[model samples]
Target: MRKLALIILVAVTSQTTWADAVSDLKNYLSSTQSLQANFKQTVTSQQGKIQNSSGTLSIQRPGLFRWIYQKPFEQLIIADGKQVWLYDPDLKQATVKAMGKALESSPAALLAGNNQFERNYTLRPLPSREGIDWLEATPKQADQSFNSVKLGFSQGQLMQMELHDNFGQTTRIYFSALKINPKIDASQFRFTPPKDADVIRE
Candidate 1:
């Protein structure tokens, strides 16, 4: 689940003038200040085992986002600019960490928070596949967990994402019902552990 959160957080990349797809994506990110979407995720392990989950996510620029897992279990990951809180309702536990410590190398962080995403990644426009404009981002730093990430867009909206990890596992995410620049409540980015939950602060 941390992988899922990490994948969504690390969104940095470098770009070239290869195609409109690349420019369109950069434009969309720059213009979009907030968004909400439903997502379906599939993780395929190196051994070929697959796990599926569904969730809803909301993001506001400059270090604020909420990701809620609603299928297969219920969990919440909320980052309120200063700190990140991970709460697992089933386990009755919540973990908290400083945002800088938690998202040091997050790709999604660049995607959602940092407007200057073209900083630490090599971005290439991939051949359109599945009728979706695709862009690939590979981190310049080799010490990261994932090898590369791919983003699929259509009609100026993000439709999908794929992350290939160093361990040979792949995580694919499809987004739907996307609301770009939607009004999201600021409270959603804040989290409070349940009364009975064990709280761990890091």
Candidate 2:
């Protein structure tokens, strides 16, 4: 028991180190203003096989984003910095929430919203994925959903992220051909629900 405790202590202590991890990832982000990229998302349920899809993701500072999934299905998750719209065509339903109120402090809050990554999380390279570098981020304060957040960056672009839920499901996101600070339209974040679509507000 004593030896196991020591091992856990060392692991927890190293996560908050500045010179090694948290600072290194912060240094990388300070150089970029905005980012856009294409991504392929794979979601596997607790007892299900892997499902794949491709999409385009765009992000701008101060909380604005557009996610248009083009493969496997047509879905849209748009955040206009003030409100969020999640539309799924197959279901013909839309979910809506005001910005900064939903998503329970998502990592994109680091890219476009007003949250500071350095203050909320510590950084460390994950050992799980081969040929991929990762950053493990833990929130500094309370009121976060997941215990840890993982960011995968390759070639200096935000390539992947995995949010591990307490229940054991991981939401993995991957990016490709990222374009930094591209000219994105403001209307991309705007929302107009389709007629007869169930609009739920939280």
TM-score of each prediction: 0.87, 0.78
Clashing residue pairs in candidate 1 (N, C-alpha, C atoms within 3 angstroms): 8-108, 9-107, 9-108, 9-109, 10-106, 10-107, 10-108, 11-107, 11-108, 14-121
What lDDT score belongs to each candidate, Candidate 1 first?
0.82, 0.71
Q: What is the C-alpha RMSD of each candidate to the true structure, in Å?
A: 9.7, 5.1
Candidate 2 on 1-202: residue-level lDDT in tens? 9999999987775553323344445644676556788888887767766788898888777677888999988999988767888999888889987765434366767667654665556655565245455678876655666667787655455667887666666678888888877787778778799897887886
Candidate 1 regions with alpha-carbon error over 4 angstroms: 1-17, 101-104
Q: Top model by lDDT, which number? A: 1
Q: Record all residue pairs in model 2 with backbone atoms less than 3 Å apart, i.e. clashing.
A: 63-112
Candidate 1 local accuracy as lDDT?
0.82
Positional deviation of 135 in candidate 2, in angstroms? 1.3
Clash number for every model? 10, 1
